[model samples]
Target: MGRPILGLRSTLKSLTRRDIKSYMSRRYSAESVFITATGNVNHTKLVRALSDSIGKIKRSGKAQVIKAPVATRSVKLVKRDLEQVHLCMGVPVPSMTDRKRFELYLINTMLGSGMSSKLFQEVREKRGLAYSVYSYLNLCKDAGSLVVYAGTSKESFGEVLTVVLNEFEKLATELTIEQLNHTKDQLKGGIVLALETTDARMMKIAKDEIYFGKSMPIKSLIKEIDRVKLEDVRKSIENYLSPDNITLAAIGGGMKKRDLPSVLK
Candidate 1:
């Protein structure tokens, strides 16, 4: 299991006032902060106001930066009393800085990012094996993962798993020009729509600053998406979607932990 983001209650209770103050001083330093304001905001006035308020903050010692744990391939199953079986399979991929990151994003969109994506169409619309199925990309500073999730009845678990795995395996060889273009268009559209909101734009700028140490223009990202070719997508699939590197987690009432491996196979 992963460590809770807010820490355990016992751990939180052990923290002293000095510890909290020290942690806040280290983590929320001026160097680590990025502020973005949208709309008709005056840059000069905003900076003056920010400087007046932020200048009072004292810098403590540098925060200790811990590396993310390396991901390994494994399957874990947790049985519960539930009506639907939920499963998630993940594969580690390159970090956000990698040039291949865009290709992975496109692959995720084509695979299961939307209603018209491969997983949704095949697993829910066509086969009726699952009510919900989608793929997502989790890109961090130093590591990333492409994950697929589905929920289905206990009886349909095997079929759903088989379909999901087959779809991933087939991505290594079977991408069409039409699929590539369509997914690109979809991604571009989503980006444009997302940036229409001031909050989204602020979030984008903050993330870009944190990750790239600079703001990346939306046009540049769109151009990169457009530049991804069919072969690039295929290569990303072959490299990141290897069967040997896959990890599976499942939660279901009727399913037994011992039956997971055979179902996955």
Candidate 2:
């Protein structure tokens, strides 16, 4: 629940059989589990099968409550003689359930979801500063963040960071109505295309239930995306994209923590 959502290998190796048993006993129960199914299936037979199997699991007294995670701002640099420097920089954003959720998605898309996005267009295509650059949102139950990642030569890392930060700062005001509409189309198209498969549909349904308590219809989702105005994206940027809230992690050769870009300082 900290910086690393996945436990470290060292800690995983230290876990004993008793630790696993204790964790399962404390966290695994009918109350804490959710079962979701999609595609062509008989509901009655499904219910019967579930009752005979998963329903038999003993019910715990109550669900284990997870403490919400907090985002921290820090810079870390790891030295290694790798071929390229890799960096992940991000800032805290609203939770998945926030009203500006769609706007956040649009912001992410406008920044770097595709080759046409600002970061890819500026950092890789036009400037040729980096080979790979993209941005994505990592949202959870009560907290979230927008992260930008890039891989480049060690000598180009500073220019790449500067270009990424410049694009980030421009999001508050420079985002145009045309760009917003194009981003909406991109996101909507992707969402519809993803629903073409059973596995994708199943995952979407599960995620919707987990995050919003009910599965939202595709039309409704598209409508939400369409409803996001340029002002909404600007407002989201103002609320969440503060430089002071940024965190940076870079792994490469010869870079020190003190060598972080001035924008991050």
Candidate 3:
């Protein structure tokens, strides 16, 4: 696959973000074929042309990256229905080239990563507020996101938002070295434990190569984890732990626009 895919380049990479999205929107007009076939796509027309060119490379020159058009989601809740939202709040972080992917990782983990995380212990355990919660660090080819989420009863929606924001402020302010270290250890342990399987190792290597442009050695990766300092975690939290970077995508009971400030106060 690499040999066949080696010479490919994104013609759309040179275009402005708006132009590229517009081109993708027009090309794939109603089809999703182009983006899936080629991992790096730029337009709808390109997708159509690629689909038409499949098994006929000479007829199409070279295969291109898939870039689905930038447009609104196909399915949107009605304004009234939006009262129950699924907030997908996130902040952009270091480029894949920065080699500090782990920093973004720890931030995600310490925030609301699991049943034991800050958000869960405070919001879920103490208050028994939400039905479910999760934290995720979505690292992409060039960029990434750190997000926290929860689904709660509409009646407690305002307080849920409040708890989330207050927790965010605490993470930025009151986080102690011990708290940070525990998070780092958990983060490192999770990765190492995941690598216990051969298939997992192969998949991780493949993903590393695809997203980070190189297959990182497990040993060096572990060493990097061990080297993470208190300052490192703090720096990541300081830059990313902000409400402004959030993009709330809510879908569920009893939240209103007016309740947005449960945390601001």
Candidate 4:
């Protein structure tokens, strides 16, 4: 919430209780100062659109109110005392525009993407090393990171963690050209779909400007990702992925720090 969505219309900003005093004095009250715009708007459409829908649902003269929890990064957490843990890891990434940034991303997707990925195929589908395993990329202002996550039973957690580390090290040294290219194609496919509509274009422009201060053409960005070489990806894995730099947010009854340090190695 440090920076709000830019697509929101300024009028939709509600009056505080203090500002309500001024609102009552003015002809254009808070209710009247509502609008809709195209760029960056999503839930922000509440002012122009949703208020009516919400009003219709409240058919009676009485009112009911419900409040949702605040923003949270954790999507799901349960306490079953299951003999396993789920771990989320993130690393530092390069700039958004850098073609090489996608190198790590491609590797991650291929290594963890569903039935076709190395992690899912080896860990979950084949050997039952884990119930869930995957990899992803997160990009921010000047840096981003490749991340991998897994849910493993406590008995298998340490062993599966070692297997994950082996997979990472293998990418740096013995990964095949075919596997690397497949991941690159996966990255390309993902980037292409991102600009599927005018709304997407506008959102990209707004977010890019907010993050990088300059808007990169979608085509140009795609070309950069397409140009990446295997060597670039290898360097990213070796240089960026490390035991000391890795941060794992883990949840489970069986989680133990003693068994985790070597995976980032």
TM-score of 1: 0.92
lDDT: which is higher, 1 or 4? 1
* lDDT per residue (tens digit) for residues 75-154 in model 2: 87888999999999888887899878799999998898989889999999999989889999988888888999999887
RMSD of 2: 1.8
Tens digit of per-residue lDDT, candidate 3, span 1-265? 1124433367435567888666555554433222222234467777678658652432322335654222222222123454444555556666555667777676678788888888889988899887687788766565566767777766776677778878887887787878777877798788889888767766776676556557788777777767877777777777776665555565665556676663332
- Which parts of model 2 are misplaced by more than 4 Å? 3-14, 257-259
Indicate which candidate wins on TM-score: 2
Deviating ranges (above 4 Å) for candidate 1:
261-265
Better of 1 and 4 by TM-score: 1
In the range 1-265, model 4's lDDT, one tens digit per residue, is 2245753566457546767654344534333232323545676565648667543332223222233223222222334576678776655556565666567567677677657888788778878888779888776555566778998887676677677777777768887788777777777787678777777766777776655567778677667767878787777778776554565566777655566544443
Total clashes in model 4, counting residue pairs 3 or more apart in sequence or in different chains: 3
How does candidate 3 fare on TM-score?
0.68
Q: In what order do the candidates fall by lDDT, top score first?
A: 1, 2, 3, 4
Least lDDT summed over 10 consecutive residues: which range in candidate 4?
A: 68-77
* Model 3: residue 263 alpha-carbon error in angstroms: 7.5
lDDT of 3 at 169: 79
The residue pairs found clashing in candidate 2 are none
